[model samples]
Target chain A: MTWIMAALLVVVVFAGIGITKWMNSTATENANENWRDIAQAEIANSMVMLEEPDLSEPQADYYEGRIAIAEHRLANDIPSFEYASMQQQVIDTHMMMSLVTLLAVIMAGGIVASEFSQGTIKMLLTRPVKRWKILTSKYITVLLFAVVLTVILLISTALAGLLFFGISDGTLLVWNGSEVSETSFWLEALKLAALKFSSVWMISTFAFMLSTVFRSSSLAIGLSIFLMFTGIQAVFLLQNYEIVKYYLFTHTDLTQFFTGNFMISDITIQMSIVVLAVYFLVFMAISYWTFGRRDITA
Target chain B: MAEQAIVQIKNLSKTIGKKKIIKNLSLDLHKGEITGFLGPNGAGKTTTIRMMVGLMRPTEGEVWIDGQSVQADFEGSIQKVGVIVENPEMYKYMSGYKNLLHFSRMHKGISKERIDEVVKQVGMQNRINEKVASYSLGMRQRLGLAQALLHDPKFLILDEPTNGLDPAGIREFRIYLQKIAKENGVAIFVSSHLLSEIELLCDRIAIIQNGELIDIKNVNDLQKSRYYIQAEPLELAGEVLTGIGFPAVLHDKGYLIDSGAEHIPGAINLLVGAGVRIFAVQPYRETLESQFLEMTGGGEIAQTHTK
Candidate 1:
């Protein structure tokens, strides 16, 4: 099911890119041709060396304003056209991330929480296996699922993106900032996708911990989604008021690496790794401690 | 009545939210003994059993299984104690056999043969392939017992093992418990409010009420304490029995005389001479129902006893 959904998402994204490209090609080509015609007329008049084309002052001024306007349009038109396609790609990327994150959360939440919700934890807990081992097994299963799901999403996005846009050897342009060569674009995207996957995994782990603690799959899923949407906002509200940015969610957006934006000075990839590792450990620690001490009679 | 104690609780107490559910409860279950933990509803029977199985820790005191404290060495103690507290929750999506297999993996050294043995022991060998969702409540209970017995634990703690069983199911379960205790030497500590069922199944009985141990007695000992003596009525049999220093209650057909064996003949002779038809003399041992009522201070037994 996960692989199938990922394939479908790729198809939809490629279809969207195809339509955007077609629409912008026509608009941009017409605008470019119109400006080129004006530039040709100005060059022709300059070559003639005709008696300095004197005219009534207002008429001369009008032609000068027209030339300035056309030059400005010629300079900025192509980028504006490209920006339309880029914006759509950004939206698609975010949408894919959201879908992948949702799937990861559900998979992780279901692995353990389903047992508790269905009252099967009693039988499982009573077995000869140590309680810690049982929890560890479930955690590993969720992590594996997250990895597989992320890989599928990344592969699908690349396949769809290539099919929609004609192959060009130009560097992949990201928001006004970071650049990647055509040869490295796919690989870089894979790396970014994997990092994005880790972010999803982080969320899934948080949900898994909540699932273990609350023993309700629905509650865990709901809380996870709510946190995903509101977490950054809450962190920003706190950080904006002179609070430290040490909160885990405050640094969750990995776009800073792709967009050349940084929330703090001297922010490095290693710092992000450290912050996430600490967050993951703290979440897991609380979950294990609570589960170890809980009475399973419930 | 074997000598070795398999499970023992001393001064155990458990309170939940201001209500004392099990209070200073002490009891010993011997090896190879099918001891019935008999009590009425809300009598703290399940609470005491839960504490014994380490499902719930006692707020005060100790529980020892196989000579180890349940609190200090919970995993070790639990390894030797098999428990089915109330309704045993099982993975409904998994096959009954798979459930057993899953639980079997938890205890080291459990073989495939042992899993099969327990499945057969519970009489679920034929239907073990079916998912637990398709199992009847009786089957689920049997499966629960099978899982509990998976590791071949020395002590078995079952709370209301036959709570929702039909008559035949209950009978079959009782026989199974007896066979396990006698054949395997497993100490069976079972709790139920069914006095008649306990009377039939358990060798020894413990009565608990409102978190307190009211009495622990051998079935035979309790049976001997009271008897219904029915005999032909003498014209003055009621007065004559009382005058002879034995109290007698008058029934519709005859007098229920409470007299020693030695005095029976005298009462019989006197009743015959009083011109009353002297047809029969029968001694009735105390029924478990009356014994339960007496032990638990006349609390209301649940109505399911009739069903």
Candidate 2:
């Protein structure tokens, strides 16, 4: 079962790259011609946003930062990274992380629950080991599975990028408040992938909690995957409320701070990390508590 | 009988959803003894077994094995115990050998040779490499037994341990259980519906009904001295037995007298002197089946009576 899930992840990665190639080939011959003009237009838009009197402090900072990066790009003659560029592929590889999260949820949901379904939990729990220790071992196995899948995603994306897009001269520019500077695309890509994995970790932990609490893998996997798709949409729905600042989905994507995509303008990355930490704790607490207290009637 | 008990369950009770599944049950198992746990359906038999093995926590009291409390020190208590609850569910995707290996790793100091020895002991070496899904029920039972014996547990708890084995396989299993109980001095607690099997395998039997232990007796006590006599003129034989101050009860076409072998010859002489034609005489013992049914009220389901 694990081999099948891993194989499916690799297939999905290659299929994603294949689709990108097919789409890029159908575009006009001058597909790369107007990136410079697009950067200039983005700079003009951010400049206009900066002139609004009612713009919040973080909102104003966001536009100013965008304008600075765009102006720096226009001055340095640096174009926005195209979809087919090797550098962008490295960054876009994390976009396939949802699939990784799905695979991970499937595994975490079944690790403990499968024992009950197969009536093997009686055999397992009757061992000399403590119940908490067994649960801890299962949780570690789930985390290791997620880590291996992430590695597969990273290595596959790198290979696929080299094969299809080849090496391209692309400069990754980041604004450090006062100026824009060049950064390694590999470092940037790693940062995004790591941030994206936080979402995977949180969702898989939630699935693990459900699996332990309910002792049903289907319910755990189904509910977790459903929330994975709609959780962000809920952030959009709840954005106007003050409570949205503490909502889980709002903080799941830590990359929003670096990408300048703030759903709530006042919230800081530090606050998001704290919120995520709290959620992680709650999920783990529920998982361990229920697992230790459950009666193995199955 | 004077030896210390290896397994002691004291005032154990379990209440699941207000049903009071097990109510203040207590039992003691000694080394070199196989105690059969017999109960009708839904008589808290499985629940009691689960509690003993620490699969379910007791609402009150405790189970101790080899001087360790199962509730307080799970590892210390269960270290010397082997359990097979019901059908001995294994990972069907893995081979029988791997299943044993998987369980062997959970215990300390269980080497690869120990696993091989157990496989051979259970006579499963030929099919141990096959996946559990491909094995028949009898084969799975063998594998289950192999895994349970892998750790060489001092106290073995088996629930329906001989469910799917053929007669030959069952005899082999019964002999193996008896051997371990006697040779290794391991205490064995077996819960089974097979009364005749229990008669042949167990040293003592504990019977439960409606969440309570109704009786605990030695097999020997249930098989007290009695003899059946078949003769012509049963009335004359009964009178002669009465004349000799012996109680004889009519049974089938004969009379059954509770007597020893020494009394039987003297009684036979007296009957012959009275001209009572004796056809046959044999030792008589009641089957465990009739005794179990009699004790458990015909072995009816216990729950429906409560409602």
Candidate 3:
């Protein structure tokens, strides 16, 4: 059921992004000629202003150079402008994805941990089921919510991008001095979403471990979230920190993977996977041990 | 009838930090009997119950249910044991029936019909559809019991089952517990500080105090040995009875005597001879409260010794 919700949410997000991009593209097309004319008029006015400059020889030279720059900027066609807009949309999509990932982590962090804090975990645990099964069920539920939420954000951003910028099989245009490719843009977006999902899982795992340890949902949630944002920074500040990079929270952000970037020299996808797997197992083991041994007299 | 032991705790000892909660506690809960675990507050009653149900492991003992050790096979032992630890918590958002259904699904081979049967048995048939949040404390307790009984477990362990219950509710709970034990032949091990309820319900009782097993006795046998004798003019009755060679302590308009019916007639004759009216010659059955107090040294030990 959770997986299905995730899939549906992903579809909805993509459709939303597509629709938004489509709408923006249509609006751009409608105002294309007017925008071109406006640019031309502005360039002409700049040329006239340069001719009337109060002449200090260097100032006149600088004014003439500015007019030439304005003319060159205006000579670029509307297509280039539209392409720049598309590039901005991709960046905006990436930002939205990051926001969505954070939201997913928060949601997953609350699911099981909240139950523990509220003392509702007693209800689940006392029911003839093994403690591990209860934890697994909660873990699965959180994963489902995370996947669904991320997919929805991704799809929505994509739909919005498609609606504003017409869908065309062309190379992605990069503005703002950032190197990005269209093929890489969508693929990276998907990978970024996956990374966010993994990061959120890591956060949820931490929350689960804390939930089991403290048996308080709010405490686990608060601590996990605080660590999620600040833990990396704290680890970075530590002088001669050799093993801090291996900390699960340090590798929680999968953006580096999607962006083909590495914060540490030896980090790789396999390494990240191994690190995450270890953290995941350790958290589960601790949770199981604590829960299994707890005296449920309360 | 095959005499089967459903639960057996052997030399169980538990210590949390430096304080020992359960000390060399050994007990046997036989099939088709209601055994009460009696103690004052923090008397290790809850601790012993939790260990039996596999909620907490004993530090130096073994708990076996249906021939399987709880530590060795917790899942197997727990599957056969229905438990309500302290105030049993249920999902407040879910309906009473839904809670039962949720628990029922966890145990393999339990049918929906059995769930409905147990709900009705616990006398919550009409209110089973109501959300648990809306239920009163007593109602929630009934629902908790219903959920515990969903899989028709062979052994039932309830901690403070009558806690927070009114007089009427407590009476109702006792009756239902008796019925369940007798009708289903389910072995019941219930823990509570209320001795009166235990006296009325349990066939046997284990008294614990300060993490020590003070005594375990048949309720009937405990009642038989202890008696309260009533006579007219209770203030002078203690001296009068002592004069008649039957020592009695004046207590609440009566004299508590360790002696039984064999000495009652002789004492009555002697009282009449001394010009004292034998207004009432009543034999008092031992209340569980008195027995518990006697076993635990008048409840002096702290009840918080749960390891």
Candidate 4:
């Protein structure tokens, strides 16, 4: 299992690096094409460039701004178009969080189920240790694995991004609903990774709890990952009912609370935290009761 | 029964979803002894061992190892116990040595010397560095013993330890278990559905049938040794044997009598005095298979025994 996970991590990081390089080249070409199209449109309309240009197409307007900025930098004799602001690095590297979480969820689902499937739980349970300690050791191992994956994700993506897009000083942008705010790039990225990890950890805990209840790794991983992908959509479809806010999937993505994206209007971040805490305790309780008290006939 | 008790299972009952697996079973294991558990299929031998080792919880009652209740303090109670509930499972991805090292982390002060000692004790020194996936069944069993003995446990529980072993491997395993029990003062509780294996391995045999303990007897006392002393004038020979307190019954060509091998000469002399010419003297001792059949009441294992 350890070797498999290591092999998977290596494959994923190299794949991420390969894709990042391809994506960077394609993105630059696409941006240049969009810039040329804008220039042709302006020439056709015979309009003067304005400090604040009016455009009906939101995408076109955004591209026009980038083109203008590029022209200004070029006029200033800047040689590189691949110079990405720190904020762009954050954006370019953000997909890694999703990949790391997927890995974390799979690892979590395998924790107890693998032991049961392989019949290794007998050896573990027979040891001179309480079931709770054994369980806690597995849970802590999950968290550590998640942390390790996240760190690999962070480092690998950072290197990939730096290799593809030259780093430049820029503000980390935060949308305040009324205006954008500037923040330290590293701190903001850290906050985003931490928030993303909160969701991963919660989903992992859910999978870990499922692992305790189920004997098949495939069943647990399949169900947990299924719920992971479709849970929010299912919750959203039923969210009109006030009681749906208390559902587990509604609060699993603790990032929603930090991002101020409320699944329910009245479900505050603190309330979500409390709900998740209650769920965490409940997951642990079920694991304790089932794993500790139940017979291990297998 | 009053000897130093290493494990005491009291009224152990296990029911899973309304079907009772073990019913009101109680047994004791003493220090410095190898006790074999025997039963027919689904007779709860493994269930009882599971309950004893805290792998399965008893419906009512508790297992006390070294005076600490497994229910109340699992760690403290099981600390003195080493168990191989079934085929010993391990992380196949790890070397046997690394596997031992990993399990040693759970218990404090399980030294490097202890690990090496157990490795040598189980005779896995050469193969300890190889991944467990590469080991044979006997080697895996030995590695399992190495892991079980790493802590120098006072009590050892093995549920069907010889399931896949060859004859020579089984002999070696028995020798190691006997050595552990005698030299380390570790009480060993081994269980098997195979009666013959139990016969050769244990000092005392515990027979359980249908979730109940049927008998616990010393190997020497499994049954009274019975012999057939055939001779001419069978009726007179039977009478002469009975008159002399041999309690012989008339049989094919002569008589059947219950006596150890040592008493054959006296019986033969008494029959000759009665002018009965002895033809043949053959010994018959009750086997574990027959006893198991009688205890299980001619159930699943009867086919094997009768054949």
Candidate 5:
């Protein structure tokens, strides 16, 4: 089962890359001389249109960041740009982290809930070891799986980039208004990888907590994934209410605080971390408490 | 103060929703003995065993193992025990040996040598390396027993431990359980609805019914002494025996008279004196099945222990 998920992820990643490369080839040719330029303008205009109904701070950063990219590409940058460039390739691969998060939810949820579903939890719980240790081992295993997935994602993208555009001595650049920062390509890639994994871990841990409390693996996996993809949007819709900021789902996407703008102005990175920490502890406490008290009659 | 008993269950009760599943039940299990826990279907045997192993919490009261309360100190108490509740469930994706190894990691001082020893003890050595998915139900039961004995726990609780075994396998399991109890001084608590199996296996038997402990007695003392008689003029012989204040029922062969060995000769002499030619008289040993049937008031013997 795990291998199947891995193979599917690999195929999805490379297939997505192939489709994008083909589209770029077709769009870049046989059009007006400034067709690429026109596309950038359209992307910027779409970002501007997303600002209605009080844009989330993270959405604002994302929309405004696209505008920045279009402005820069239209200005003094190089004339020819390819998506296969190392940094762009890395970003494109990392952007598919929702796939990683989905698998992580299954892995984390299956670890404990499978025992219950299959009636094997009696053997697990009756051992001399404490219940907490069992749950902790599964949680750590999920974290390790997250690390493995991140590494696999990075390696696959690097290999793809090397295959498409061999060995380029290009600068890793980030645009912040008039100021631009340059860093080692690998270092920048690692930072982006960490940022992507942060969001994955958040979803995985939520799934792990649900697994502990639930006997049905499908329930845990389904609910966690459902919330992961829609939880932020739900909170965004509710953001008009003052209490929405206190919602854990809103804080679950802590990447907003660091990689972009905070949806709520007062929700700094520190506040987000504290909120996440509280949720983590509460989820863990519920897991241990329920596990200890649960009757394994099944 | 607990009489040297390794397992001391005190007033254990469990209630799920509005139904009181296990009433206040108490039991004592000692080392070097195999006690049969006999009960009909839904008699709370599995529920009691689950609470004993801390797989389920009691609504009230406690189960103590070697002076440690299962409710209060589950690890410390459960460390002294091994259990196979209802059916032994394993990860079918892994080999039997891997399952044992995984369980061994949960305990201290369970070595590869110990694993091999248990594998050999349960006679599963030949197929230990095979994936559990390929195992027959009997083989899985053996693996389950092997894993339970790996820790050398003082008390072993097996709920319907012989679910899938053939008759030969069951007989062998009974012998192994007895050997473990006598040689290793492990107290074995076997809960099964199999009366015949319990008759052959247990030293003492505890009976339960409808969420209550009914009775506990030695296998030897399960039924009172009775005699079977085959005689010419059987009706006359039965009438004479009944007239002499012995209640005699006419059986297929002759008559069934409730009398001890000493009175058998006297009854025979009376029958002969009454012109009844006595042919055969033998002491009838009551099977545990008949006793159980009589006790449960003709209750169903095929009790299913489902968890």
Candidate 6:
């Protein structure tokens, strides 16, 4: 089971890297020609939106800003950063961290629950080891698996980036609401990927807690995966309420602060970190309490 | 009889949701003794064993193993205890050797040599490398035994240790357990429903009925000598044996007399000289099954026994 999950992860990550590289390679082959065409098409598309009669003031400003960026790109001959480049791929790799979260969840959800299901928990608990120590060992192992898989994802992405597209020179442009400015793609990728890993760590910890509390891996994995999607959707649904500030999914994506896509715009990075830390503590406490106190009937 | 008790279960009570599963169960297990724990189904035998091994906590009282409390000092108390609770469930995904190695790591100072020695002791060296998934039930039991013995535990608690073993395997297991209990002076407590097996394996038997320890007796005490005599005119034979100070009781078309072999010969001579015709004479004994059924009130469930 251990080796199979890791092998599947490598295959999946490599496949994702291969597919993304293929999709992005065609656009960057003729960089200048492709940029000009893309900018013209983008300008035309934004121009139609700018012509809308009922467009709100901010909406109209957003479309006008997009048109301005495209026009400036064409005028300055600043082609959009090539997605096939190593820096861009490293920056974009975090987008696929949901896969890492999934694999980590599988590992965390089974680490302790499988012992109960297979009836080996009796053998495990009857030893000279205390229940708390056993639970701690399992929790540490789950954390290690998550960390290892995340590292694998990062390494595989870099390998794929290096293989398909060697180093490429391009300027990363970001519009700070009024004007486009230059940014370091490598720094941006590192920040975004690190932020994305916070979500993976939080979700996998949640899955681990469920695994120990319920002593059923299927239920833990299923419930965790289900909540991972629905919980994020719920943040948008509850955005109008005051409770959204404290809701777990609202803060799970720490990248929201940097990406200008906050579900609850009032929440700061510090607030999100605090909320996530609280949830993490509650999950860990429940896991330990239930595991240490549970009767080993299995 | 003068030996100190190595495992002391004192006033151990388990109450699960208003049901007293084990009611003030107190017993002492000494080294170099094989103590058989016999109980009907759901009579709290497993519950008591689990509490002793720290799998379940006792609601009241505690189990002390080797002068340490199992509830308070689990690691210290259970350090020298080997437990095989309910078929010795192991990680079937790994090899049998890996399973032993996995358990060996949980202890303080078990070496690779010790694991190999235990594997060889259980006669599993040939197939120790094969995954436990491929092993038969008997082989699994042996591997289970190997893991239990890995740490050279001073106290061994086995719950149905011979559940899947064949007759020969059971005999081999019994001999092995007896050897450890005697040679190594390991305090062994075994819970089993097999009456004849317990009779052969245990030096002392503790019988539990309806969440209570109803009887604890030495195997020798249950093996009193008596003789069954089949004679014509059973009434005359009974009178003749009773008049000769045998205290004969009529049972199954015969008179049962509790006496030594010398007295049995004389009693038979007097009975034959009288008008009673002696047809057969044989030794009689009460099986453990009958004694267990009698003590447990026909082996009904505890709920009925309570009312």
| Predicted structure with the largest lDDT when compared to the true one | 2
Report the candidate with higher DockQ, 1 versus 6: 6
Candidate 6 runs further than 4 Å off: A25-81, A170-190, B229-250, B253-255, B266-280, B299-307
List DockQ for all candidates: 0.30, 0.79, 0.31, 0.66, 0.65, 0.67
lDDT of 5: 0.80
Taking the tens digit of each residue's C-alpha lDDT, what string does model 2 give over B1-307? Answer: 9999999999989998888888889999999999999988889889999998888889998999999999999999898999999998999999998998898888999999999999999998888888999999999888888878888899999999988999999999999999999999999999988878999999999999888988999999888899999987988999999889889999998899988888999999999999999999999999988888788888373342232
lDDT by residue (A1-298, candidate 1, tens digit) is 5566556556666676677667766775553344356555653553343334544333333344434434444454421122333322442463467677777788777777788777777666655455677889889978787677666655555555555553432233222112211224555556566656656878998999989888888989999988888886786567555444566775675655543334543345666778888898998998788777676666
DockQ top scorer: 2
**Per-residue lDDT over B4-79 for candidate 3, one digit per residue giving the tens place of the 0 to 100 score:** 6888899999989998888998888898899888777777887787778666768899999999988888778788
Ranking 4 against 5 by lDDT, winner:
5
DockQ for model 5 equals 0.65
What is candidate 6's lDDT per residue for A20-94, written digit by digit as tens? 767765665564346678779878987997787765454555567667778888889887766567777777877
Candidate with the greatest TM-score versus the true structure: 2
For B38-154, candidate 5 gives per-residue lDDT tens digits of 877777888999989988889999999999998888889888888898778899999999999999989889999999999998999899999999999999999999889889999
Residue A273 lDDT, candidate 2, scale 0-100? 90
Worst 10 residues of 5 chain A by lDDT: A78-87
Model 5 lDDT at residue A295: 80
Ranking by TM-score: 2, 6, 5, 4, 1, 3
Q: Rank the candidates by lDDT, best first.
A: 2, 6, 5, 4, 1, 3
> Per-residue CA lDDT of candidate 5, range A1-298, in tens?
8788788777776777777666766785543245356547646675665856766555555566555555555564533324556556775555677888988899988888898877889998998888888888888999898888877877777776666555544444555545545556677667767766767887888888788887677888999988887887887788779888677776655556435645565466666677778877888888788887788878
Q: Write the per-residue lDDT of candidate 4 for residues B103-179, one digit (tens) a residue.
A: 99888799999999999888889889999999998888888888888888999988778767789888999888888
Q: Which stretches of candidate 2 lie over 4 Å from their true place?
A: A34-42, A52-63, A67-82, A178-181, B229-257, B268-281, B299-307
Per-residue accuracy of model 1 over B1-307 as CA lDDT, tens digit each: 5486888899998878898888888888898899988777778876777667665668999998888988787678888878787787788878999888887777878899989998888899999999999999999999999999889889988888997788998999999899989998999988877878899999999888788888888986766532344554444666666776767776656667555577777766766676545656777576888878877667467553543
lDDT of 1 at B240: 61
- Cα-lDDT of candidate 2: 0.88
Report every candidate's CA lDDT.
0.71, 0.88, 0.70, 0.76, 0.80, 0.85
Error of 6 at A196 (Å): 1.9
